[model samples]
Every structure is written in C-alpha cells, then in structure tokens.
Target: MSRIEPPSTDPVNSKPARAATGDGLDPGGRRRARRYDPDRKTRILDAALDVLAEHGAAGTTHRRIAASAGVPLGSITYHFATLIDLRAQAFARYVEQQSAVFEELLEVVRTREEFVEILVDLVHGGPARYRSAVLGFELHLAALRSPDLRVLTQAWTRDSRAALARFTGPDVAARLDALLKGMIMNVLLATDPEPREATRAAIVQTLGPADGSRP
Candidate 1:
C-alpha cells in the first residue's frame, strides 16, 4: 500500500464538509439540504404543468421537472418520492392557484349577469390559460381517483359555494355552484362546442336574475 497521504490537503478536507443533521438543515445555517423550498416547489409545480401540457401525463419525469424548475435533478426526490405524489401535489397546487381567480371574479360582480360575465371570462380566458383542456381533465381525473385529492376538491367546492351563496343567497347558491362547475366540466370534456357565453347565459337563466341586494 502506498504511504497513506496525510489526508488530502483540499479545502473541503481542511474545513471538513459539514453534514446536515436530522432536519437535513445545516446546524448553523437557515437553509435545509433536503427540505422543500416553497418558491422552488411552486416553480417546479408550474414547470411540471407545462411539461404535462406538452407531453401528457406519461411524458413528465423527474429530470424534466427539474429542468423546468431550474433545480438539480437530485432535488426532485428530496421534494417528492413518486411521480404520483408529484402529480397529485401539482394538481392540488393548480386548483388552489386557480381558486384565487374565481374568488376575485365573484367578488367584483354586483349582479348575477356581472358574475356570469366574470365566470365566462375566467373559464374562457384567464391567466394560467391552457392551450388544451387536457391538463384540467388530468387533474380532475386524478382527484376523482384519489380520496386525498377529492377532499381538497370538495373543500374547494364548499368554499366556492359559500362564496357564491354569500352574494346570491343560500336559496340559489347551490344551484349556481352546480351550474358553474357543470359548465367547466362540459368545457373540459369538449363535448359541448358551444361558446362559454352560452353557458354563462344558462347560469344567468338559472339564477333568474340577481336581486342585487345583499342578504
């Protein structure tokens, strides 16, 4: 055996590489080695959505998501264990992100027509717009199959219904919620080629005109 070199004279050796503890966070530092970054996770989720939109469900992978997120490939596993986990989280995030738009639209409208106009705009053309309905379908499909996802979906439905009811009153809120969700589902399915305006009109008809009075 060659004479044992007195430990290599590298800076890493001289300084001794610090290992992250049980928390995966450096003891003296604020950042964690294996912990998820909220910003990074959001970016990764968005990138994952883009990848899914471009290549469908099966085309997305850790490397692709990492590339999209502009993070190292190793960080993917650090944040998510399986593709399903990643997909589920991404879908959940998408739903949560979209809800803000719906809430804002509902908030501004004083009447049912105004509400429907906003609804139509949101469905037909809003920020985070998709070229095709596949991504929406994919998320809905995943939620349909996963109880965890369904819980989140149901919460969204309940919250949305409550918001609409706040403006439209309990008497019509349920019906309005059903119409709005149904319209979105129909659009996602692509079975109804009718303009979103038609769906909005249908919802307005269901509302039978806004009372324009706070309950």
Candidate 2:
C-alpha cells in the first residue's frame, strides 16, 4: 500500500514516467505480504499432538502435520528440524498440559472417596482424557527408540509421581504410577471397560492401609 509519487504528472521532459515503486511491492497489488502469525508455532505443536495421538510417531510427517495445521510443508521444516524432534516436543507439551489437568483434578480431593473417584475418572475420563492417554502411550513407545524422548518420559514420570504422592505416600505413588499406566493401556484396548467399582477397588488397594504405607 505504500505508493510512490510520479514525476510531476509526466510532462514533455519526463515523457510519461512510470511511478517509482521501490518498496518491494507492485503498484498493481498482485502479491501479498508475508503473514504475521505469532501463534504459528503453537498451532503446529497442537497439530503435532493431534497427529501423534491419532497416527503414532510412525505416521507423523511434515506433510501430514502441515495439512493438519493449515501451514505450508516448509513451515514445518522451518520450525522443526525433523519429525522426531516435533514428536518429542509435542509429547513434552502434552505432558505439561496433562500435568496441569492432573493437578486440577486432584485439587478438589477432600477425602479418600474423592481421591479414589478422581483416579477412576482419570482411567476412564471419556473424551477429555482419551487424547491425552493416547499421546502418553505414543510417547512411551517413541521413547524406546529415541533417548531424547526417553528423557522426557522419565521426567514426566517423576513429576506425575510427585503429584500423586500428595495423596498417596511416595512409595504408593511410585507403585500407583505403574498401575495407572498398565490399567490405562488395558482400558484403551478393552472393548468394554471395567466398571467404576472395580477401578475404585484397585485404587484403594493401591492406597494400602489408611496409614499411607505401601500395600
């Protein structure tokens, strides 16, 4: 839109001079300026998580992520060096987000009943927890091949256990983390998930006696 003035309307001496448009844009407006999307990287990361949850790391590609995020393929390369890097970062973000959700879900626990119910909800949290659970498993599978991803999973495990330790003691929290992983993976594969009562029993057993000692 930055226009250049003509040479005084172009008289005999000027001989119909054209406008001086040296601002890297044509006067005819054929081309557009580069878009300013400050949140482009964030959108790409979210789209990466979506792709990972749906397709696992094996199916994730720059082209797929580009299409999902509504960005150019080159944009994915510009932001992320490789699909592996993207997957690891995406899982990191998921862990960060799920960590907050875990805290919020536990924030309302006032009794053993409430804590157990919350753990049950976590196992079968419906759509709210489904995507996160998928991403968690995908991260674990990916970590087996990528040491960087393994580091992320290790830290995620530590933090998750720390959060759970607030309710159960550290020993129980550690065991609970393993139990939740197995139970969640099982639930994901089960055509008909076990009833909430069964999940509650498992959680209570994980909690051991009321003294917070390991069962």
Candidate 3:
C-alpha cells in the first residue's frame, strides 16, 4: 500500500480550509459576517402588519413574523420581548402612519364641502384602504383585551380628534370621530358602500356646518 501522504503543504492547496464563522454565507461560497440593517426593525414591524392582516392577532407569532420578515428568529425577541410588546409597537406604527395620512387630508381642507368630499373619498378609497381599515379594527378588538394596546388606541383617538378639531370644533370633532368609525365599518361590511352623497349628508348632519370653526 502506498504510504499515507502527510497533509499537503503546497502553498495553494495545503492550507487547511478556514472554518465558517457561523455568521452567514455569501453566494460565492465564502463566509460572510452577518450584515447589520439599519432598517431591519422597520422591516420587521411592517412584516408584522402584513402578518396581522393575513393572520389575526391570535395567529400571529414570533416565528411566523420572523419568517415573513426574512429575519432571523432572534431578531424579533431582540426588538420586542413579548407578543404584546410586538403588537403594541406594530399598532403604534400603524397608527402613526395612518395619522400622517389623516393629517395630510386635513391639510387640504379649505371648506366644509371639501372636508365632506375628503371624508367620502376616504370611505371609498378602495380595497387597499379597506385592508388597512380591517387591520385597524383588528387592533381595536385586541385593545379591548389588552390594556397596553388600549393605551395605543387611546393615543390614536386623541390624535385623530385633535386633527379633526383643526377644522371642526372639539364637539363636532368628537362626533365626527364616532361618525367616521361607524361609517368606516359600514363601508367595509356593506356589499356596496354607501354613496358619497349619503356619506356627505351624514357629515352635514353631524357637523351642522364645516365652516372651518374650531370650538
């Protein structure tokens, strides 16, 4: 039998292959360090929303979200310690995003008619918007069972009322908030959402006049 050759010492081939650091692997067959993504948290949060929309709060889990987010499982725990924490943060993000849109819509309202038109358009903004509305409802239902989530809901309501109060007075703003919630639910559940004119009429009845008065 040929004598067993000692390990190759050739400079090109004799070097023992470096062991992987267990960090990650690039496509080129070289080991790579785990990349840090500054926006990873944001991605995870958004993924959480998609998961929430697809699977109700009861079905959402860290593993499911991590898979959806394409993040390592530990990342979820790294950012949020518990499911409640994740839900709270995700809902907070959703509220902030929706509030920005609400503020933008309010910014363009120069007259009561325009305000009514905006409200009507919002109700009829279509399926994509309806998904967000559904998500909102999901969060609301969850908030009922979670004081932590209720805090977020409370802040959202306060901010929404404050935004509406910019054009309508505090009293009308409060009523309008309630009206909006009901109208949105009706719009989402109805086979055919109520007509813009019908929504307009409701607004007119509720606010009396959107004459840009903030009491």
TM-score for each predicted model, relative to the true structure: 0.69, 0.81, 0.80
lDDT computed for candidate 2: 0.75
After superposition, the stretches of candidate 2 with alpha carbons farther than 4 Å from their true spots are: 1-32, 212-215
Tens-digit per-residue lDDT, 94-158, candidate 1: 56655665677666777555766776765575435544346766655666655455655665666
Candidate 1 vs candidate 3: which has greater lDDT? Answer: 3
Question: In what order do the candidates fall by TM-score, top score first?
Answer: 2, 3, 1
What is the C-alpha lDDT profile of model 2 across 1-215, one tens digit per residue?
11111112112322322222443245886644757999999899999988888888889877778789998666677676556556666777777777777878788878777888888888877886888888898888877866556666776787889888888878989999998898898899999988878888998898877864321
lDDT of the candidates, in the order given = 0.64, 0.75, 0.77
Candidate 3 Cα errors over 4 Å, as ranges: 1-33, 210-215
User: For model 3, how does the per-residue alpha-carbon lDDT over 1-215 read when each residue is reduced to its tens digit?
Assistant: 11111121234422332322432556787856657799999999899999999898999988889899998776777676566667667888888888788888788777777878888887777878888898999989987876456766776788889888877778888999999999999988899878888988898799884343442
* Candidate 3 least-lDDT 10 residues: 1-10
The alpha-carbon deviation from the true structure for residue 142 of candidate 2, after best TM-score superposition, in angstroms, is 0.4
**Candidate 2 vs. true structure, TM-score:** 0.81
Q: How far is candidate 1 from the true structure (C-alpha RMSD, Å)?
A: 14.2
In model 3, how large is the Cα lDDT of residue 94?
87
- Candidate 1 stretches with Cα past 4 Å from truth are 1-38, 131-134, 188-192, 212-215
